[model samples]
Target: MNIKITGSGSYIPNRIVANADFAQHVFLDEKGAPLTYSNEVVADKFRQITGIDERRYVESDLVTSDIAFFAAQRAIEDANIDPETLDYIIFAHNFGNVKAGAIQGDLVPSLAARVKHSLRIKNPKCVAYDILFGCPGWLEGVIQAQSYIKSGMAKRCLVIGAETLSRVVDPHDRDSMIYSDGAGASIIEGTDDEGGILAHETASYTYDEAYLLFFGNSYNKDHDEDIRYIKMYGRKIYEFALNRVPQAMKECLETSGIDIKDVTKILIHQANEKMDEAIVNRFYKLHDMVTPERVMPMSIHKLGNSSVATIPTLYDLMLKGQLDDQVLTKGDIVLFASVGAGMNINAIVYKI
Candidate 1:
């Protein structure tokens, strides 16, 4: 028996925030001092490094769960499956739903349960839960779904990755530019088909890397120090990801018995254009080859980094033929990877 992604969908918010949008904002350094350069110089430098021109944000009327439900609905419709038949719904996210103008996360009911409720799935057997694995959350949910299907705990599952980061960002921090809001979902089920998820790998470095990404006080010291928002050591995290992620991908690919040349698409987490490129290049170098053309599809230029939503969101867009020059055909081997908070890393070798 095999587990496969039978359907996929994504929710891209309507609001477009371009790089020029930050021109008048005050960007501060760690010491609470304003940057010496103008916001234009800073934004331009950021563009060159991250390849982000614009990003999406959920309107004030919506929250994370709303978009998660939106993506889930489309995925269900695409799969053409009865909601009541689902055996599980796994939601992956770091920060839960945060209301507009609010600093706290609302998780009284888990996001997965919230989505399951919103989905109107009345089957009590549909075990719903949430996983906080940073940017890899979505892929990790897929891995969990694969395990459930393989272990006979489930036959059909829905895995969703969604976030509304615009509400939680520190407007004063330059790193906030890397965040956006979006959601992506997939329907996974047991199949008799020939190709599916082949192998997966996961790693956690908690000793030295634990604090690479964390929630910290606003960069503007005047802002309440007790109030924290998503934060990271960008350079340190970049260096760490470049060194670790490729090795995990290579190990997963080898475990699948799939040659590096067979990987036609690499739907990596859309973190940063430069970091992702360096990681992919290193992966190929490990195989004694070079990175292949069009093997890597990216959405960061416009979508920015929606944390756990990146990989699944990229997959949904590609499968729908929305991504220029990218498409997935039957029997194509694909690789998915991500590294983020928790200082976590993961990769999956899959056949589509």
Candidate 2:
């Protein structure tokens, strides 16, 4: 059986925080001189690298569930399906409502209640749950739902990814200036097409590299929440991507009976502009394939790195005409891939 994405939706909070706006949070030097770390530098970094100039932040009143529900509503509307008909809902998000007592798993029942109340339907078997996988999450969620549909466990699935990176960011840190909030949703239905997930490959280099990048978590005292704020060896991450991602893509396509030329576009994780260019160039040299347009520039710059929501958010944005249009078409092959903090790299081949 084949699984197709029949609908898509995305949500960004109304509040927009520009790079310059970040300067207000910076500290001054001992000499009474403002630190050199200006929002201009951070914003310019995102703009030059990702082509993003602005990103949205959730208001203090909003949380992950609010974002997920809104995006899910749009996805249902786009698919022209009633919420009561959705057999299952896969909510992919690592960051939960910080205001709540627990993480995403604990927040699911409440979210489901809201959905049930809003749609005025009763779904005892609705089965809403959370999956954690950093930035490669949406694809993982898709793959997981494929299993349920293939087993006849469900007729339709709504996969939603909602993130509030700002919840984990250390507002006092310059690096935290880049992350913004956003969410996205997609409807996956079973099909007979053999082309859905033509190939998928996941690589985990578990070692010190696993500790190379981290999101701050204060709720736990064991890891010292103070150390939980975003921490990364920038140079290490860059080198790892240059060496690892290209090889991962090559392996995925080769096993799928797909040649580089067969691919119309590659939708990679939106880490940044530099990594995007590096992966594309490396892939071109490794497979002699022409790279498609860069789709994450505006997102990375404006939306910052949204973690797990990055890919789906970009997917929703591109389809909404926020990015290049010629890149996606029916029967065209597209590659979705991501590499993130877990030291995990996953790539999935899809057809438009």
Candidate 3:
């Protein structure tokens, strides 16, 4: 019983803030660099690094659901599925449209309303809600949806990763450069076709490492001030990556009963160029696996790090220009891997 991803879509804003333009808005240091030096260098090295050349952000008055609704509409159309058939609408987010309110916490309900309203989904009466867990949130949603569909709980599910990281990023920090606002949706439908989420495995190491990657000391002193904002011990997280990710990948491949050499493409979390290189190089050394040539280049040059959106967005990009060809033959394997701030690493095997 393989659940297949019938359609996948992403929502990017029309705004294209060039690196040069971003330089104008941000302050510079004595060395003629952005106050956080790394972002400055990233901007100088890559044209799209400083600002999303095509990023999406809702107006201050709008909500996350609004952005999600647009993306959901496209995804449903791409899937060629009627909205009336949707059984569940799972909204995933870490940050939302409105701040915590007295009545209903964040904007999850609004997200549901907007999606249903935009698509005019009726009859099956989709239930909507939010799920969040660091950057790995969407991957978890995929697994949950896969289970639900396989269990007969849903015939089709709209799984969304909607985030407004800009809300929490400390305007003063360099680390905040990695977080961005965007949404990605995958239409997972129950089918006899054998190409959905085949296998998934996660490994977590509880640590105060979260402290290294977050901020907000004055506002949330009671909680780890780090949790309130994005905080990262750059070198330390890199070290953790090199140590743990390979093992997780190895286990994922073994559990799927597929050799690494058999994988046609390895879709890694868009954490950073260095992390992807380390994992790709390690796997290549062990098993001659070719990281899909097209997606690898896009990771560094085209899309900066899009957090959870990276794997799915990259997968969508790779699927184009090739779906018509015979390169991705039946029985081929696609590997999806991601690591998040909770000191957790995950890898899922997809048989295409």
Candidate 4:
């Protein structure tokens, strides 16, 4: 049995936040006093390091499920499938919808359930749930959907990755510059054709590296107060991705019996442009070859990193020819890879 991604859609917030926007808010020192740093300096440094000029943030009233609902509706329309026919709604997100004016995150209904509700899906048989796999959540959801289709248990599945990182990020922290809000969705269905997901690989290194990137939900000695925000050791994560991601991609390609040269595109997570480029370069080096310049498409410059939504959003943009000089055709081989907060890494090979 084969599973094919029949349709795809993505939604990014309308508000565009430039690097200079950070200057308006004041960051506090340990003494609860303002730490002075010019917005120009901060913005220049951010652009130099992350290659992000701007990113989008949802309106104050919007939640994770809200963006996901928009994306899912577009995907279902694209797939030309009835909402009632969907067997599963697999939503992936690290933080569920954070209510307006609320500091803490909430997931009482689960993002998947909320999306189903908003879609007005009345079929009780359509199971809905959520997956928390850091940035790999979206790919992991697809992998699970593949299992259901292969087992003859499901005919169609809606896999969505959505996040409002702006809600979870600490505006006082520099890491917040790399976070954004968006959602992407795909409709996967059982297919007799051979063109679809061919192979996949996933791994976790949660022992020591688990602390490398974490949410601060406790008192911070450095700040002399309680803090709950996304925190990360940038150097550690950069080193981890440079070392681990390429190997994971190579393993998936080898397992699928596909040659590196035959891959049409490499749609990696839009975390960092430089890191993603290096990972692809390193993957090709493993096969004693040079990386192709046009193979990897990127949107990090405009979208930043929306956690699990990165890859799916990029995939959808490419599918619709919204990306520069990129297009997919029948029988094209593509690779998808991501590494993030879980210290989790995943890769997948698919035929378009």
Write down the lDDT of every candidate, Cα atoms only.
Answer: 0.93, 0.73, 0.64, 0.89
Q: Candidate 1, which segments miss by more than 4 Å at Cα?
A: none
Residue-level lDDT of model 4, residues 1-352, one tens digit each, is 6789999999989999988788786555434455576767777877877899999999998999999999999999999999999999999999788876677788988889999999999999999999989999999999999989888889999999999998877666666889999999999998788789999999999888888888774223354245477888888999998999999999999999998889999999988777788889999999999888789888989889999999999999989999888878889999999998879999999999
Clashes of each: 0, 8, 4, 0
Cα deviation of 192, candidate 2, in Å? 4.4
lDDT of candidate 3 over 1-352, digit per residue (tens): 6687788777664544344444434533323345545555655644433333323344555456766777787778889998888888877665556442211236635565667767776664687767655666677778878888888888898888776565565444444555555667888877788676667888666765555455443222233433455556777887877777877877778888876666776777777766677877776655665554543333423344556666665555555442223233467688777777677678888876
Task: Kindly report which residue stretches of model 2 are placed more than 4 angstroms away from their true locations once superposed.
Answer: 27-46, 100-121, 192-195, 215-228, 289-298, 324-327
- Give the top-scoring candidate (lDDT): 1
After aligning candidate 2 to the native by TM-score, how far in Å is the CA of 275 from where it should be? 0.9
TM values, all candidates: 0.99, 0.84, 0.79, 0.94
Per-residue lDDT tens digits for candidate 1, residues 105-127, read 99869999999999888999999
True-structure Cα RMSD, model 1: 0.8
CA lDDT for candidate 1: 0.93
Can you tell me which runs of candidate 3 are displaced by over 4 Å? 25-42, 45-62, 98-105, 108-110, 123-125, 215-228, 286-297, 322-331
Model 2: per-residue Cα lDDT over 247-272, one tens digit each: 98889888878877778777787777
Residue 201 in model 2: lDDT: 85
**Higher-ranked by lDDT: 2 or 3:** 2
Superposition TM-score, candidate 2 onto the true structure = 0.84
